[model samples]
Each structure stands twice: as C-alpha cells, then as structure tokens.
Target: MERLINLNSKKSLTNEQRQAIYQRLLQESSNGKLRKGSISDIANSYAVCTKTISRIWGRGKLHVNEESMVDVSLKKSKSVGRKKKQINLGEVKGLPFHRRSNICSIANSIGVSKSTLHRRVQEGALRTHTNAVKPDLTEANKMARLEFCFSKINRSLSNNDSTFDDMFNVVHIDEKWFYLTKSSRRYYLVPGEDEPLRTCKSKKFITKFMFLAAVARPRFDASGNEIFSGKIGIFPFTTLEPAKRSSKNRVAGTLETKPILSVTKEVTRTWLIEKVLPAIRAKWPQGHTGPIFIQQDNAKPHININDSRFLEEASRDGFDIRLCFQPPNSPDLNVLDLGFFRAIQSLQEQESLGTIDELISAVQVSFERMGSRELNNVFLTLQMCMKEILKVRGGNNYQTPHIGKGKLERQGNLPLQIDIDENLINEVGSYLGL
Candidate 1:
C-alpha cells in the first residue's frame, strides 16, 4: 500500500501518480476475495476521494490489457473543451477609416472588447506609427539628389564595385533654434514628492536662440584613438548691447545679450567669416591638407557660394575651404539634420536657463559633451540614406536602414565606408539619362 498523504491539499495529482494508484487497486482485486469496500479502502490509503477512485476504475475498465491492467491514454482529447473566439480581420478592416483610428472605436465596431484588440496589437496584427509631412520633390530635385549621391562615390580605385569616400574633408553646417523650455514636460517622482512648477509669460513667446553648428567626420589613428574630434564649433546668433534703462534685474549701462531674431545674408556671412572660419582653422587636423567642402542647405538667408568675402577668407590660412549647397527639399542628406541636432537638443533641454547667456552656455556645453562616435554614426547614416535614395531613384519614400551598428562596432567590424551596388548605380545612371 502507498503512504497516506494530505487529501485536502490544493495540489493536483499527475497522470503517472493516478495510474500507479489504479494499478495497485487492480493488483489487490486480482488477489481474490475482494472486499465490498475495497475501493474506499484504497482511496483512503492514497488520500484521494472515493469518487475520484471510482472514476479512475471506470476509465481503467474501458482500456483493459491482456494482463487485465488499465492502459488508458494520459493526454486529454483536443475536442473536449470549448473552442476559442474567432475575429474577422476583413470585417474590421472594412469599417470606416475614421472609426478604425483607435482600439476602443474599432472594438465597438467589431463587437469585441478593447482588450481583445489590444492583444491583437501585441501579437503584431496591428501597428502604431506617427506620420510626418515629407517634402515634395520635383523631377529636378530628385535628379539633383541622385547626382549629389553619385558625386560622393569613390570610383578611382575600382570602377566595378565603387564605395563612398571618407567624408573627413566635408563639413556639415546648419542653423537650429533652441527654445528656453518646452511647454509640456514629463517627470517621474516619488509617491509623496511634490511636482515641479515652471512658468513662462506666454508659451508662444518663449525665449529662443538660433545657433549655427559645424561638424566634420572624426579621425582615428591605427590604434583606434581619436586624434581629431572634428567638432568645429557652435555659434549663437546673438548680440550684446548696454541696458538703456534701470530695471529690477539690472541698472542702466549694463551689458545685456539679446538674440538676433531675424537672420539675413549679411548676418550669415559675418558669422561664417568671423566665427566659423577661425574655429575650423584652430581645429583642422594637421595631417589632413586637403580642400574642405562646407555643406549647407538651400536656405535664402544662407550666404551664396560666390560671395567674395567668404571666398577671400576661405582661401587664407593655408586651408582650401569652399561652400556647397545640398539638394533642396532633402534634409536627410545633411548630417546635422539627420540626428546630431536632435541629440544635442535633448541634452540642452535638460538644463535650467533664465537668461540668454545661460542658454548659450548650455547649448555649447551640450554640443561639446556629445561623443565623436555618435557624430560618426550620423555621418554613416547619411551615407545609408544616400544609398536608399539611389535605390528609390532619388525618391524619399523608403524607411531608414538599420545595419546593427552597435553589434558591428562591438565585433570590430564597423565599416568606414558602405559599398554601393554596381547594378543599382548603373540603373540609376541610365534612368537619369547620364
């Protein structure tokens, strides 16, 4: 007889345990002169109810072997329980477009609960995406983008399989307006902690400063140590003037800095000559003695390439630098616009600033705090975007490609240049009538 265990315990018996009990009962019955209460006696010894033993014996009798022992199936039948509810995806999709905007609305239309629709979303039957307005590209813009990408290909080594040139000689410059603070901010706090309060005269009239940022591709030696970080500088569009009247914060004749709200051709030219050139001259890698291209967007306020003052200053200091314009309506082609500006903006927004000086300092510090590897990755992304543009025949309708940069960098397999498909290049060239 088996040892007696707790019958009131919540734990259920396994199939093997139940089978052993049945076999023992059958063996006892075979010994002859079975008692009238033999089933109850066995159930009491096994710590199971009499009804459970009776059911097991009933199932055992249905599948008796040659030796008169039960050999019943352990697994339950598939058709024994209730079936799962089925959802008609076609009916759900056929609902009005506005009605299918959210789970609650869609579920109500389909006569299902929101939780069921949420489960489908979790299972990838539905996806959530944020749409933004993309620039409308004309035929000329598309062809220009294609030509720009083609110019970056390094075909001197091998014409069959061309690769992109290392963009160390190219500097990406752009202007971005950094605001004092966002209207809405999110924060995490302890249960009993007080919420942070911030105020502004008007959200629409928040203090903002426009800054011009310039960056080049970082250089590394054979040992993988960065020799030149390629951070030229970030200059703010602000000017200082003395206070003409007494105020609570300051007295008359006190020098106060104010942002230059309107940027013009003259302002752009002045900063490029005074601030941008000097910084590039100071930070330019000594080993690299080649012409540098300062790439900018086709903004009207930007200085023209043929500006005599810029050309004159650019040719000085033993540096061959020139200004070039990227394709219009294509912000993805610029490294700064691709991701660097947003990275620095996120860091800058973390600081508290009450004055223009503090804002400028915060932005400059954030720009310097950014890692060179991140900037390098943005440059790589620019190349990948170029490849995508070529693939789509210069149409910006494709998603950005993720090449697992982190994993590749960890394995020391991160490539300096991405190779362009020869067939793609030829096909794009033929399509462009080049």
Candidate 2:
C-alpha cells in the first residue's frame, strides 16, 4: 500500500495516454497483476486519478485472456462534448446579402458564436462564396467570342483531335498600372518587435505608372533549350524632365521621371512605333521569320490599328507584325488577363521600390525573372479556358480548369498546347450560327 492519488488532481485521459499507462502497469507487474502502488505511480506520471488508471488496467486485463493486444479506444459517450448549436439555414439565408455578408453577421442572425459559424464553414455545413460582377455581354459579344474560339482551333491539323494553334507567332499585349505600394501588407514579426509603419501622401495619390506588357509563347529547341524568352518589353508611360526646383531628396536640374497622366491613342501609337516594335524586332528569332500577330483587347486606344501610321511602322524591319483584337469582354481569350499580369505584379510587389524609375525597373526585372515555362503555361491555360467557354456555349461562366502543369512539367511531359473534343468545336460553331 502506498500514497493514494490526489482526488483533487484529475484529467480525462486520451486513448493514447490510457494505453501508455497500461503499458507502464504491465512493466511494474510480475506474473499477472500490477505491483503494489503501481496504479498510483502510473496515474501520478500521467496527471490522472487512480480510478482512471484502474479503469484502463481493468480494460487491458479483460482482453488478456482473449487477445494479447489491448484496445485502448475511448469509451466516453458521443454526447460528452458541447452540442452543436441548432442552425436554421432557412432563417439564415433569408437575411439580406449585405446583412449576412460575414461570419459574425451570419452567426448573430443564427444565434451562434463566430467560432461556431467558422467551424460550420470548415466542416462543410456552411459555405462561403464570392461573386464578382461580369461584363454585360450582348448577342454580338457571345457570337464574337465563339467565333474567336473557333478560329484558334487548328483547322490544318490532320487528326480529329481539337487542338489549338501553337500561337508561337502571336504576342499578347495589355496595359496595367503598377502602384508603388499596396494599401495593406502583411508581415511576420518576432514577438516584442515593433510593428512597421508605412505612410504616403495619400493612397489615391500614391505614385503609380501604367505599363504596356507584351509576351509571346516561349519556344524550345530540339533539346528543350529556351530559344526566345517571349518577354518583348514592359514599357512605362513616363517622360524624363529636368527638375524645376531643388528638393531635399534631389538636386535641381536632375532629370526627374514624370509619369504620363493619360495614355491616349497617340501615346500608345508612339510606344508601338518606338518601344514595342523595336523590342520585337530585336528579340524575335531569326530562323523563323514569320508574320507575328499582336493580340490586344478592344480598348479605345487599341482600336483602329489598321490605320496607316500603325501598319506602316509595324511592317518595318523586315517583320510583318499585325494587330488583332480578341473578342470584347472575353479576357479569358488573352493570355495576359488569364493570369500573367497578376503573376508579374505579385513578383514586382515583393520589392521595396520608392521612385518611379525604381518601380519601372522592378516591373521589368519581375517580367524578366519569370521563367519561360510560366509564360508557356499561361498560353496553355488560355486554350483550356477557350475549351471551357465552348463547353458553356461561349459564356464566360465557367470555372477555370486546372491540369497539374507543374507536375506534368516535372515529369517532362508538358504539352505545348491543350487538345479538346472535336464535337465541342462543332457544337460551339452550330450554337454561334457559324
């Protein structure tokens, strides 16, 4: 006989803890029974009472005659924990969209804690959805989108497999604004470290510069060596001007970067003639001297590129670079909008840039830092989206498909293009009255 387990000290032992205690009891035992005070010794080691240890030992002994392995599964009733709060989904869904916009609001409406509602969401009992406003498409827009998808399908291919054109000659161009800093940023800081403070003149007035990015599909040689990186150029809309007045940061007469407030047709045309076309000429592969098509959205600046000014300049340098517009409101058709711009923007945001020049440099660096494989994947994703659009009869209301591009690439089996069903193409054409 030894000291008794303190009744005041008690805990609900887990199945693992009970099994551990039973093993300890057997170790302290001789032939068949636990030694004197072994129950108290094991219970005190596990921070449980003597009765809890005894119950575990009893369970282990009951299985001794029948089986060597003891089942230490918990015997507590299912009703031991707190009951799930009753949720009337009808009452919850009846709330206005704005009223139940967040977990807290929905929880209050259903008379539960925020954690309970969040738990329900995690357990799939409740779901969170996000809806974004889509561009209003008319009959013409849908037909145009359908026709565009039909055009991408390689009609020249001999097989019945509905594969998209390799699009090696097509370059995607899009305009996006690069801000100096994000409004809110998350940072991981060590405990007792002071939180960072970042301020600007105003968020609306934060230094931002627009860029026109152009990328073509990356090409690989027989050995998979990268031939052309497909990065044409990321041109910043800024003009260099000498500083009129001296500032604490810079001396007077220093050429300061002045961002172009508005990029009109003239500005876009100038970039094409001066910046974009030249970069394309220099970077385009010499062996494959084909007519490169510049695919762009139907923005006002991009419209009317058939004019002599654009055609005259584009036809220069022994390269025939033609301008073509994707269907209106069909961003999925363009590789840039499908995901590339966001990818480079995310990369650009990682840097701490201050001046307009620095921001421009960061954007260009990010554009270059992107591997050719990612750009190629975006093109494949563009084809996948076109396939999805055809499935929905040219509507943009389709989830983007995910084929494990990285996994496939790791296995050295990434396709240059995605193939679709031949029937989908015919059905889309019939739906569009083509």
Candidate 3:
C-alpha cells in the first residue's frame, strides 16, 4: 500500500520519480493482484504528480489491435488523398506567377500542396526556394572583394603564425525574439527522442522581445581555464508610444492603443541621454575609455550607424567603439539574433503572455535562463560559416570554386567565370573529376 502526498502546486513530476512509478506498476502487474492504490495514487505517493500512470493503467497495452491497426492504415490513406486535393488547389492558384511542380512531386516530397506551402510561408514557415537564382555578382566588384579577402588573409598570416583561427576573428551580433510562455507549452516532444530536445513553437510567431548580443570565440584565463565571456545587450520590445494609428487615414486622428515603437535609433538617443550614459559612467567610474570593435547587422536605422548619441557618449568617456555591419542579408553570421529570436518565441508561447508588460518580463526571464554554453554554440556556427566562405573562395580544391578574388577581380574574368557555379553545373558537369 502507498500513501499520497498533497501537492503544493500543479508542478509536474521529475523523470526519476516517474521512472520509479513505472517500476512500481510493473511490480503490481507481475504480482497479478489488485494494485493497492491507483496509478494517480501511486504517482502522488511517489511525488511524480502526473496522471500518466492512471492513463497507462486504464489503456492497458499500447500495442494496436488488428481492427484498430487497419483503421489507422485506412485513415492515413484518406489523409494522403486529401493532401492530393489540396495540392491541386495550389497548382491552380500558383499557375499565374510561379511554376509549381506536379502533385506527385508535392505528395512524394511532403504530401503538401502549393497552397499549403504558401500558407505555411505566410505563417512564417522556414521554407526555402529550391531553384532560386543566385544573386548577380559583377566581375569588377568580385575582383576587388577577392583582393581584399586575400589581403586580409595575408595580413592575418603576416600578423602572427596563428592557424585558421587567426584569419577569422569574426564576432557575429544580432537580435532574437523570445516569448513568455513556459518552455513546456512552447515545445512538444514526439517521444523516444534524444536528450536536450527542442520545442517546435520556438520558431512560431509569438509576442517576444529582441536581445542584442555579441558572441566571440571563447577565451581562456591565464590559468588555462576556458572563460565563456560574451557581451549581452538588452533591447526589450516594449512600446513607448501609447497611441497607435487605427486606420491609414487616421494617422493623426483617433488611436486604438498607445503603441511603443521599437528601440530604433531615435529611442536609443533618448534612452542614452536619460538612462544609458549615467549607467555607463556609474559602472566604469575609473573612466576606462578605448576603441571597441562591435559587429552588428543593419537594423531599422541602427543608432550605432545613424545616431551619434552613443558614439558621442563613448567619445566623451574616452571609449571609441566602431560598429561594423555584417554582410547584407546574412543573419546566419549573427548568432545572438538567431538565439534571441528563438528564446523570445519559446517563452512567449509557453507563458501565453497577453499584455506587453508580461511579454517583456517573459523575454527578460528567458535571456537570464540562457547560459554561456548556448552562446558558444552560436559562435561555433559563425566559425563554420567563415570556414565555408574560405573553402568556396579557395583555388582549385573547392567543389564549386568561385573564380577571381572579389567583385573587382571579376571584371576582367567574367562571362567566363560568370556562370562558374551556375545551377547547370551539376546538371551538366563537363569536367568529370574522379
């Protein structure tokens, strides 16, 4: 017989306790006796706090019966048929602009139609164009960029006898979104998966905040211990403006709710004057000032790029920080942007946050919960990207060598090297290397 404990809250059970209950259930079944207590009774007794035991007990074996197995097979067949219909609908609509593949192509791939694909895209699905054309890179500009790249590489080699790491001291900086919902609610486990599993809704649209952060290679102290020190800058997605425009014509008219615009350059100017400058002075009272290198992307009129408030403050304080923009349209280079956004989406969905204040709090909590290990993963991704660039820009060893140096180097060599890495290469490989 087992005794139940009163739960202070609706907190879920830990894995160990659940496992214990499973052991106890097995013992009861093997004995062929009426269990002293019900599954929930045993769960509460062992402090598992889950109704899963009761569910498993009532459901008996999970193995499907013959009739039910056939039913499920038929259901899947019907689902496939419905999917075909949906794909036909998409082919009709997409006929005007896009050249969609046949229904067989769609079904065999994911059993999804063009309409479903479009809806998923509209819903912010991470879909990619399989046959998208490469962006045009003129020969001249390509040559220049190649020369610059080689110059940088040579300068790196000349500066020190450092390995590949020396050539790429890239610090990727970007913002990410995080929601306030509990992580459990945000992510779902398909069951029987590996540890450290991720939740799905982490990529979904949720009310989340942006975090500006910079991830550098993990450093080590003089004692040979690794120090995972990275910079974290907070940018809460809360509104300052209370009044929001309801309609196009009502920009200056009646408002629905006061809207707090994002912390753009304008907001940073005000924030620095009021809160940031004083905080900086108070934190570094020794008056430390020097040139700081910051890597960031081009956000909507970034303060570091357009506004002089931060620069002026840094200058006044004797700290000259240069904010270098990452390559255009390259979010993969910005680790924090990816991490922060995932965090934002996860927390917001988990907490099911309603109000703006609640959302901000959730984002703050999510960032705090995120540790340096996760940050290191982001940095590693950036390193891999640099390695890939070096590989493609290499001489003859690369798979699809991007001939010439940079944009400028391409001027004299193009038309010849223009379609060097064209889509037709795999389709028609002339130089069949073993």
Regions of model 3 farther than 4 Å from truth: 1-218, 222-228, 237-259, 262-264, 271-290, 304-308, 338-340, 343-349, 394-434
Q: Each prediction's Cα lDDT score?
A: 0.86, 0.85, 0.45
The better candidate by TM-score, 1 or 3, is 1
Better of 1 and 2 by lDDT: 1
For candidate 1, list the clashing residue pairs, or say none: none
Each model's TM-score, in the order given?
Answer: 0.81, 0.86, 0.44
Q: What TM-score should be assigned to candidate 1? A: 0.81
lDDT of 1: 0.86
TM-score of 3: 0.44
**How many clashes would you count in candidate 1?**
0
lDDT of 2 by residue, 1-434 (tens): 22344566556777777777778888988888788988877767776678877887788888997777788668878697677776777888799999877998888887888897788789888788887767888888987887888888885366486588899999899999999998899999999999989999888788899999999999998788999998898899999999999999889999988999888998989988889999999999887767889988989877475868889988886789898888999778888878999999999999998788889999999999999989999999998888887787778888889999999988989988888787777777677677
> Model 1: runs farther than 4 Å from truth?
1-86, 91-101, 156-160
What TM-score does candidate 2 reach? Answer: 0.86
Per lDDT, the best of the predicted structures is 1
Give RMSD (Å) of candidate 1 vs. truth: 6.2
Q: What lDDT is reached at residue 54 by model 3?
A: 61
